[model samples]
Target: MNHLKFLLAIWKANLQSVMEYRVSFLTQVVGMMLNNFIYFAIWIVFFDRFKDVRGWGINDMYVTFGVLASAFGLVSLLFGNAFTLGDIINNGRLDYYLSLPRPVLLHAVSSRMISSGMGDFTYGFLSYAVSGPFTWDGLLRFVLAILLAAVVFAAFLILVNSLAFWMGIVSSFANLMLNAMITFGIYPITLFDNYAKLILFTVIPAALMGAVPAEYIRSASWQILAQLLLGAAILLGLAVTVFRSGLKRYESGSAIQVEV
Candidate 1:
């Protein structure tokens, strides 16, 4: 309970800080919305020419994109530091976190915010609103799915970035893996074979982060929701366990720092 309060205070501070820069915040938010719309346009064009592939249709594409964007945006909005966690760990910035009495991972990851994420988060519901499957039940399912997918994404980021505890400055490798998930996530999983699908579900977790959540929103299947819940729980537990274990081996950067 106290931890929750602490997190709320941190988030409130972050929100206030961003809100202070109103024009810049709005510009970033609007720019991100436009970017997502333009990227989603590729699917609009593809479906225009090829129509549905297998069982997937344009509406399905919209749902998938919405869930993906929402999950990504939420992570970026609240846990923006996840993207830079590897660099932070590599550069000895964990020292700042270590000296604090809070939970290190949570504090470190929640300390930053990306204003553009608001746009993506807002546009997600706009996509869903137009997808024609909005129901009281589906809306509830969509919200649940968004939370689960965001958990998986946050876990995946931790899983990869925690490697920086051992390997110094792995930003390039981390970026490649992140790009793979984002690139593959926006597409219909039906386009992939069993092997690739396996990779998506396990190694990169793109399917869990995007496809499963979208499917849950579309069908409201209890089994799909259960799978997402179980996947998220397992991955989060694993990620936290790994990070805690790695912290024992964490050493400060050998590079010297001089104060200005």
Candidate 2:
């Protein structure tokens, strides 16, 4: 109950901050939409050159990307400040969070909102809606997969941000991880060879977060379902462990300095 209230407070505060700069908020959303549209266009061009890649047609790829992209947009919107965790740690802003009664990780991240991500969310959802011959079962699977993927993705990002406790400058690494997940992880893992498949499905686990869940929606295989649940469990467990471990290393700071 207390956690729910804290989340509500964070939502209100974030909404107020976005409302303060209405023009900038809208512009940012527009810019993000254009950026995402360009990327999808490039993928379309690539498919035009090649008929199909690994038995997955261009349209199938579109649905997969759309689902994952929508889930990613949602994750970023609610947890946008996660990327700034490194900066917050470096500058001692984490001190304020540590002092708060609620979970510092949740409070620190939930306080900010990303209006730009709404554009991405809209684009992905529209793509998914348009490029579909989906049945009721397929739709249900897709929705469930997306929800589970969002949880795993959030856990992964939190795990990544926790790196700030040890390495003060982690922006480059975080950006690299995000890119790799989008580029290599978003595509169908079955297209890759055995070695590459192993890396994606295990080491990075982008396949589990995006591709595997997508496959389950498309084919409803029991194997795929099991993998999705297993991946979510592992990712969530790792995230919690990493976060708790990092918290112990945190040191609080105050702006008021004593002059020697």
Candidate 3:
């Protein structure tokens, strides 16, 4: 509970920091949404030319894109530091977090806010909205799906970023992993064979972040939701364990500074 409060406080601080530049923040958000929309236009062209790929249609892309973008947005917004953690670890900046009274991982990952994430988050709903045939229940289900997807994706980010602890500098690999998740995530799951599907569900876990959650959003299958829950728990547990283990070997930069 106390940790939750501390997390909230960090979020509040970051929000306030961005609030000081509301115009710029709004621009960043809107710009990202436009970027996302334009990027999806390529799929628009593909689907227009081909109609459908496998069992997935244009609407399926919309829904999947919505969940995947929102999941990415949540991480980018609330846990923005996840994207930069590799650099932090490599640069010895983690000393600041290590010296803090809060849980180091939580503190390290939640301390920044990427304003563009708000754009992604808002655009996700817009994408879902246009997908049509809406309901209160479906909206609620969408929320649940994105939350679970975000958990799985964030865990993956932390796990990859934590590699910096041993690799010295690995932000490129971390970015590649994240890009793979996004790249593989936006496509239809049926396009892959069983072996490739297994890799998506485990190695990259893009299926958990995209395919599974998107499936749940489109179908509301209890079975799919169960998969989401189990995957989230497992990935989160693994990421936390790996991060803690990495902490044991952390070599502080020892650049002393005071914190109030």
Maximum-TM-score candidate: 3
Question: Model 2 over residues 1-260: C-alpha lDDT tens digits?
Answer: 99888888777778788869989988987888788878778778888998778787767776777777777777777777776777676677777777668898788777677888677677766666656785778777877887777777777777787798898778888888877777876576657998998888665778877777777877789887887888888888997788779888877557642211
Write down the TM-score for model 2: 0.89
**Candidate 2 C-alpha error for residue 72, in Å:** 1.3
Q: Going through the candidates in order, what is the number of backbone clashes in each?
A: 0, 0, 0
Question: What ordering of candidates by TM-score runs from best to worst?
Answer: 3, 1, 2
Q: What's the CA error at residue 49 for candidate 2, in Å? A: 2.0
| Over 4 Å off, model 1 | 253-260
Q: Could you estimate the TM-score for every candidate?
A: 0.96, 0.89, 0.97
Better of 1 and 2 by TM-score: 1
lDDT, candidates in the order shown: 0.89, 0.76, 0.91
Off by over 4 Å in 3: 256-260
lDDT of 3 by residue, 134-194 (tens): 8999999999999999999899999999988888889789989989999999989989999
Error of 2 at 41 (Å): 1.2
Q: After superposition, how far is residue 6 of candidate 2 from its true place, in Å?
A: 2.3
Report the Cα lDDT for candidate 2.
0.76
Model with the higher TM-score, candidate 1 or 3: 3
